[model samples]
Target chain A: MDQLYTPSTEKCELVSASKGTVKFLLDYSKSLSIVKAEGMVFENNLN
Target chain B: MEHQTDDSTLVQDYISGDERALEILINRHNQRITSFIYSKVLDRDAAEDIFQDTFIKVIKTLKKGNYSEEGKFLPWVMRIAHNLIIDYFRKNKRMPKFEGGDDFNIFSVIGDEKPNVEKQLIKDQIDSDLSMLIDELPDDQRDVLIMRIYKDMSFKEISECTGVSINTALGRMRYALINLRKIIQKNNIVLTNY
Candidate 1:
């Protein structure tokens, strides 16, 4: 147990550390929206 | 296995007129960063809006040749997300509420008696940084830690949920903390109060 678990002395300040996985999938349409938005940014930057 | 390009190299490539580099970077980090923002906002449209705004800022910064964050691209982008989340809350005049009982409130731990945006934002930035570090943990350990800390579950509850014994649950929690410390040190992440 000692070798497996070394207790951390660092203070825990996280309010809540939930799971990192997104609940909703990014899906194709939403991703395309982002791509479209990026295209607009590139176009504007060029203009 | 195929070789995956590191974020800094991709960022440099994007800066040097390689459009594909930016696409790869965005696609690589899109899920995690979007999940982070969505977790905070809890509104799909708002989260997506902020995500777009974040990349827009990233593009502007890179285009102006002011992108000096070196290899720390994800954290820098997360900071931008953090600021945008704060802005979203300020504009809406509210904060994201934890969905559990009175066991813990994130705002309580991070906020003052009176609402202080600056302190809250700073603490939120630290929390966001910590969240990124937490992502580095093994899935099993991360599941145990999230159940124990975020869900406020007991060892017995965690064991029951994960179909393991209470002792195993406790062991995983312990290992989670130990590994979290190692990851923090390895990444040079500062989790202290500013």
Candidate 2:
């Protein structure tokens, strides 16, 4: 009896929450990539 | 040229003190790993901090010759990221309660308060965050979440399709909801109709 279940719009919001989080991560990773690339270029110039 | 390289090769190179290889590996898995952490914490600055911490741990573990899981480098690093997310929760003294030491059920704790027009933008932002986080869930849990939330499948049907017990499917859904609520609270997500 304790395990009865029901669905709500909140559940849908949960899915949306995860989707937005991943999108942010992808966007942030791009900035990190640019920084890494610049560092690599500098290192190559030094060598 | 680096695009054709596989993870194990990069891991071995890193173990041999080739920092460039580690950089390539990070570049390869950074988005997925970052997304996974952001899904749990839902804070950009916090996610970035944990992201850096995760890679620091990866470097230390590899340098110490303790990375035993060969050919599974990304998953290993992700495990580290997940653990750090859990550590963040524990450290903040806001860790979600788990049932039977497995499933985290926080639906009851999530307030049913409705947001007004003034908080519409904030609610929209939170909704977007939730969307991305769901994509980063572990395969099994994500599958259950998608089936239950998006596909609107019953736990019995989920078990039939995934070949797990009904209880396992139910547990996954519970954990999914709990994790979502935790991220929502941690990030100050404001729910509203828009």
Candidate 3:
């Protein structure tokens, strides 16, 4: 976790350490689960 | 900070009909949680959105008594984040790029303690590329990478959370690195050694 604090140059570094689990969790969920409030359903559904 | 009421306990309480328990956990983790999310997205607005969603999800799911209370709450939160990240990419209709920078930026805050030029340079180089590569990885590989790189969970712990053998976790990491290496190679970029 603390590895992200290292001062490395942009040209020399290979991986991004700032990506902690906290950030990963938040960033991962952006724009998740589209809105289905309008009774949106598949054309093939036999309702 | 006497029993301190760790997150696992709070989560259990929340599941067992105590609504305030979730609030307590959120209050404790919110500040740090925002910064953590910011690192992955690199955009404040987007990070905030995910942060809110993460809690909403916890609330919605907790009320339903979906968690097992196995005492490994952090990993559970992280898994939710992993899924969100995948969803983010899908909605954007853009693939994550490997060389796009940031070679493990999770350590960014810590390295600020000392003034070292070389270290600063390395951190800078890693800024964007590493994140993109992480985003580029397949879900299975990315999930394992999150366990090792972000959460710092041991192989054993990861296996338990993922319900797989230790060997499976190791294999996922192995292949993730291979694919990462391939991505960097194709891009004509070198990471570890100068």
Regions of model 3 farther than 4 Å from truth: A1-47, B1-3, B94-194
CAPRI quality band, candidate 1: incorrect
Instruction: Report residue B14 deviation for candidate 2 (angstroms).
Output: 1.2
Off by over 4 Å in 1: A1-44, B1-3, B94-194
* Weakest 10 consecutive residues of candidate 1 chain A by summed lDDT: A21-30
Tens digit per residue, CA lDDT, model 1, B66-185 = 789555999999999999999999977765444567687776657768637887787889889878777888999999999888889999989999999998988989999999999888
For every candidate, what is the interface RMSD in angstroms? Answer: 8.8, 8.8, 10.1
Share of true Cα-Cα contacts across chains kept by each model: 0.00, 0.00, 0.00
Instruction: Please give the C-alpha DockQ score of model 2.
Output: 0.03
Worst 10 residues of 2 chain B by lDDT: B96-105
Writing each residue's lDDT as its tens digit, candidate 1 over A1-47 gives 68776364222211221222121221211232221354353323211
Candidate 2 per-residue lDDT over residues B1-194, each given as its tens digit: 88898888888886776767766776677677777777778666677778877876666566556678654887887888889998998987775543443464465457557665667767777678778878766778889999988899988999999999999998888888788777767778656544
lDDT of each: 0.72, 0.69, 0.66
TM-score of 3: 0.38
TM-score of chain A of each: 0.17, 0.32, 0.27
| Candidate 3 C-alpha error for residue B154, in Å | 52
